[model samples]
Target: MTTQHLQNRVDPWGQLRTVASRGTRMGNRGILHNDANQVVRPWKHKRWVTCMLEFKQIKRPKPFSRGNYSELFFLDEATAFAAGHRPCGDCQKARHLDFKEKWLAANVDAQLRSAISMDDVDKVLHAERCVPGGGKTTFAATLGELPKGTMFEFAEAAFLVSAAGYLPWSFDGYGPAKRIDGATAVTVLTPASIVRAFEQGFVALVHASAGLDDPAAVASAQKNPS
Candidate 1:
């Protein structure tokens, strides 16, 4: 329960604060990482969890949506999946065993290798990591909202959203929305972009299913597809 309780906690951002150094400076998890502090501190009631795949620490922008869902918690919790954490045994034992058996990652903000491969990252995260579980988090923009096929060149290959669709993305351990104006102009495809994410699989580092907020939510969705 300590870790659950730890979720609500906030951390102040300062030059010394880890998040601040990493450029998680703006609107961090609905909180700010302040500077000029003698010590680092955490926020209150940080009980939400990360249930997606994340290999590296990406930098996210402000004005995003984490989204309310049937089962997942927070996908934009900045530090949620960067290191690693397994599922709760009481609610997710079988998957938890599988997770532990594969890779035991607990997100640590300190400098170190987070994941060897994207699959290595997935082992600790649930497959259903989505934005702002239940309106708690979100990506403000949409694919149609962005210039279709616009390219954002970070360190990796150029990323383009399919046909002006909106999808969630995280860079340098932070998450944000990436939009493309047209399908033909880009190579990036997403569940939201192609609208057939089930078949495509992990276009981004993380994503969530329709039903993944909690046990009750998951159970309810299972009974009712709508």
Candidate 2:
């Protein structure tokens, strides 16, 4: 019998999955290990974080080692951001600093702008991404209002908005682009603050399947309404 590894892949709704994929960061989903090299818990904490794959030549810990945090993976920074995680300060110092700089600049509130710590940013993100009852937080908005790299839920499916159109998200990869009316109201899955970051020129790396950067693909998508 094959033992199932811990559910670690983060979807657009911030739920955990066991799908396989390439991820740039190894995140923490709390301690889920047991003596038998199996996950005994799904998550033990709420402070989910995204860290650089390697740090300072440190020896890698055995995957899902006992007493260690469960390893979660994201397709890219965009996916990670959508899943309500921030860069790990220790391993991802440069990225964390960049994120903090953009996060503070995006805030309109003077008090928030004055703050220099990631804790404040995390607090705001926590509020926006999680509800009081322990579910993912979501907001309503029109497709046009959201910037590129933002993910949203519509028709009970998750999609990534891009220059081409709405790319359907799947566990394996993104599907073809589907055009939508700009004025149509949709449920945005990504946090509002992170959405602002996208608008402020902080781009999130999307999967190659998105094809947003491919002019031919974008033109084809425009020609074919799907």
Candidate 3:
């Protein structure tokens, strides 16, 4: 047999689509599909950290993708589901858009059947995005930028909160709840830059009071420093 024969016998790993190391299995039934092979493909997922399914309608698809890089792949639907890749909007745009619209419709239907309020639906959406700042980044200069706060304090706060998985949301209560800006409401919240500011301030307060030989003065300074 020629080299071609050996190559033919081997599976084409080249055809495999690239994806992130981590992925969560979507429980939506539409994610499973069969084509007479008894195999099923999951509906949709992300190509990377950013892209998310936004506005959509069932009748037409407008998938969000990054063009050719967002190529769709699946030896079959089952394998595609197994590998956990979803239709890309920019590349595989149509299919993904269709999936979103259908998902929203089904979600609304299920909620109605259960007599859940639209508010409940909003909560579900909120939980899904895992927003720490009311789903609006004050830092957004572009579509995908991080959210910043009025004091730029929120931005610093978010950098740490995002690492910890605790979105503290903004305090504005009007525009958007920013995790960073919200935390700053303490008047002395932690930030990457100011993580030790309060602690150091306390120590300085203590030292100054010790010089003055007055514990009461130290405590006062610690509580309300000039």
Candidate 4:
């Protein structure tokens, strides 16, 4: 028997797919699926976030139930961040708070406020990642200038800047690393504000396939600081 999958897997560009892999993180944007278990809309609210796949060992038999928020999966936190999602304040409270603090510190001039709320971050992120009517928003930046863990589009494909190289991204996992040039300008898929947060020392968790755990890759990366 073949198991059918739902169209709920989100990519770095925030587009939904029916991939077999469930990914490391899950999140929602309110009730976007209909009673028929079909995604009828892109999003239902501005508060888009990414959370742990298993929170408090909670179990839900019907993930796409009509009234409940649609369950969305991302390959990893890096992918989620690139897709304009922040950590969930419920399932991933500590992560969310850390992200918020770093994000607020990095975007001080963006909001012009003494105290920043998650809603404020959501508003800024929504504007940076989404178009008014439709489509994902992107900005241009030098590939090497972007911090490690940032995702960018290069040669019509998505790649994560791992160490000193770029790892090709896919729903299943990342591919081999490719050398990166500091002078190469590219369109970054991640939101500008999130990139700023990453620059401010906010480290995002990536899959092991990113070669972050490999000692040789680390040494190579250290030797070639791109």
On lDDT, the candidate that comes out on top is: 4
Which residue pairs in candidate 2 have backbone atoms (N, alpha carbon, C) closer than 3 angstroms, thus clashing?
none
Candidate 2 off by > 4 Å: 1-3, 32-46, 108-112, 212-226
Per-residue lDDT of model 2, residues 10-61, tens digit only: 7878777665553544678677667765555545666668875557888767
lDDT tens digits by residue: candidate 3, 195-216: 1211222111111211222222
Number of clashing pairs per prediction, in order: 68, 0, 20, 0
Comparison by TM-score, 2 against 4, better one:
4
Of candidates 4 and 3, the better by lDDT? 4
Report, for every candidate in turn, its global Cα lDDT versus the true structure.
0.26, 0.72, 0.24, 0.82
User: Looking at model 2, which ten-residue stretch has the lowest summed lDDT?
Assistant: 217-226
On the 0 to 100 scale, the lDDT of residue 214 in model 3 is 21
Better of 1 and 3 by TM-score: 1
Residue 185 of model 2: what lDDT? Answer: 99
Clashes of 1: 68
Please tell me which model should have the higher lDDT, number 1 or number 4: 4
Error of model 3, residue 117, in angstroms: 20
Per-candidate TM-score against the hidden true structure: 0.24, 0.82, 0.20, 0.90
